[model samples]
Target: MTVHTAPAPAATMFDVRNPGTGDVVGQYPVHGEPEVAAAVERAREAAVWWDGIGFDERRKRLDAFRGVIARRINQLAGVIHEEMGKPHGDAYLEVALVLDHLAWAAKNAGKVLGKRKAHAGPLNANLGATVEHKALGVVGVIGPWNYPVFTPMGSIVYALAAGNTIVFKPSEYTPGVGAWLVDAFSQVVPEHPVMQLVTGDGSTGAALCRAGVDKVAFTGSTATAKRVMATCAETLTPIVAECGGKDALLVDQDADLEAAADAAVWGGIANAGQSCIGVERIYVHTAVHDAFEAMLADRVGALRAGADSGALVGPITMPSQVEIIRRHVADAVASGGRIVAGSGSIDGQVVQPVLLADVPEDAAAVREETFGPTLTLRRVEDMDEAVRLTNASRYHLAASVFSKHHGTAIADRIRSGMVAVNSVFSFAVVASIPFGGVGDSGFGRIHGEEGLREFCYAHSVVRQKFASPLPLMSFGRTAKVEERLGTIIALVHGSK
Candidate 1:
């Protein structure tokens, strides 16, 4: 006799709270394994219909989805600000960039993924060969809360453009934003659940990994990413992880001190420094270290963390992150590091910017990813020393180099997947450049041509146009024919 077990039922419910205030914003059901598996099955069914439609029709639908998002950009931004605690302006910027990516993916999908002719070598003179990229049937996306709209949309938009359906499991901290996005998309394409949403905590995410989707896309911390990978490994499911990073910024002696200071302040403290590619460490040449430190301190002093309308920095989104931020600051100061700018203080969820100078490379503040409004400054003897220090970390996601004459040369030496020359975070806004990292920062890309193909599968086709002059594949080949073939191979390839 064979045994069969029933799917698990939906479990408990949780409340979404505003981090700035401890008030409950909304409530969501904690979907269980059964719900997650059902969502993936529906996505699988929808993928068939979605892929059957031609690229032109798919473009129309995707463009319509983009239109819906654009029209309600402010509304979506409001949700992001409320749930994730980022400033309204910063939230708006996140949504705007997502819109740009959507437009690029819809416009370039056909040209990038369509079938193209391939040249058949002289050895196969009578064959026609071509290659095309097809959609992976269904994709599972586990998103993050920091930049909820922009980060997950990097996978969602590309997957949809590639003609695959999506079952998105957003971070438990920001389910409202995810629900809003899916609702807006549904208004555009209502026939099928082309883009579905399943709200829950980590258990739901783990379930999605075991739900048999064609591929899973995850964006989170390095520690959490490992757990996600382990769960996916149980089912032999493929996953793309855009994990954490302790990114760095390098300033050469020839660099503009004012510009470097400005970039450092913004890159390190923006969004309360919650971004994966956010600048956590700054390595400046010893010659200009003092001047740069002064300018950065002034900039940091001008910034304030509050929930008020005039405040530029918002409160920390995740509650657990506040302790980590405090620990890193305490650790830096305990290791003989000097506080240069704002005090390393935290009152409730709002944490003021903490700038530390002369911190050792081995300190936790410099070694681990402190996803808060904190910056550590270090002085290096030369650009070589700066590059050496920058490349010495375990996490290498993105980096920035500020140099007057050797920006490109300095950028090339860094081990990060992407680097900005004379700028910071510039690679993220550009739709054509790939976004991802190597090593502990996580593998697999999420943007550009590589990103569009990330949710797709390559397909090749070959056809015989006529019979070959020499029948080598046949079992009845004469010994003389085999000898002639060997002689021809030796004459053509032996010299090389």
Candidate 2:
């Protein structure tokens, strides 16, 4: 007798909508485990050819990819704007910043990862040592939606420069942006699928993590990071997570209040405040608290959030984030805080930028990552108090300090991964400095020399130039040889 088996269910497709206009920008398949695994398999085969090419050839191809991005920057920016709900100009700026990083990674990869001579210690003087960083096969990159082009490129570009093929799983909200990136890369390096795209939701990302990729580079919330970590733990796969933050901005007594106010408004509300390193808290020195607060209120009050061309702030990209913003605002007001600038109204996905004053330290608005166009301001007795309050948060991702005379001193006291002195978010623009945080912000880094090494593993080699006189590593060693070695070591190292 013969038995009939049921067929597997078909994979579903989802629409990408614009938060500002409520229009479907694109539709993508919810790539499941099978599709994700197939993409990784292709990447693995491509990795072999990618790694075989010398650094000079890789640099030339990477430069060509950079050229593709530069020539079509406006088209890519438009996709980012439509899919992620940011202003078109801001999207252009985001894509423009990525060009600098792409160039830096391409130009510096050889210098950073090339083989170099390593010193052998006195005990092994007759041995020669060398070290280099080699590609770790295929890499899985899980990107965020807020800054779609910029954030993921921190991983994709660096990993590519280091000679690893990539399988990118972009956030569901902005799959079009990811597709555009992959297509553009293919135009430059058409020989193989050096970089590929797999669009889907959380399940797709989990599948990539479990698909035997050499490494996973993820950027998202701390809560979600835990889940990714758990999934990767199943296979003991290594990962680098760049998570969320509740960053702070400090104002010293001698700070330029005008500049501080400008930085606070831009840092707190830009991109509708969806940045992981966005300024969510402000600690001002009492001497200039009143003046700085007045300037910040005036500037923020003039800004508006909408789909209009002139609106400085855009709609919240993710719909669920609106509820979080609403809850934080209500909690701040109910806990004795007053809205200093905004109307505190949530109209659809457009949340007017709100500035809160006198919120308690333990309030949800102050302690949590609001992820909205909101700011909570508090006055402190001095710079010492400012530093203390700034370092109190569980998220130590990034911070900005404004002081005419003591900018560096105050920045040094704050405990965070990257600090901007007399400015805001400047560190992220520079390609040489590393970006990532300690504690809840997640471990491992992206961007800079450290980021290049993140996707590669160190390879060490030792060669013997001559036999050691003492032959410490030999089985034929005798007591007399050991005695002479002890006396020589004591003579060399006994005196401090």
- Candidate 2: lDDT of 356? 98
Off by over 4 Å in 1: 1-11
Expressed as tens digits, the lDDT of each residue in 1-496 for candidate 1 is: 1111113443577899989987899888788888888888888888889988968898999999899899989999999999989999999999998878998989999899999999998677889999999999899999999999999999999989999999988899999998898888887778787888888899999988999999999999999999999999998989999999999999998999899999998998999999999999999999998988999999998889987778899999999999999999998889999999998589899999988998999999999999999999999999999999999999999999999999999999999999999999999988887999999999999889999999999999999999876788899888988888788789878889
TM-score of 1: 0.97
User: What local lDDT score does residue 133 receive in model 1, on the 0 to 100 scale?
Assistant: 98
Off by over 4 Å in 2: 1-11
Q: How many clashing residue pairs are found in candidate 2?
A: 0
Per TM-score, the best of the predicted structures is 2
- Cα-based lDDT at residue 104, candidate 2: 94
Clashing pairs in 2: none
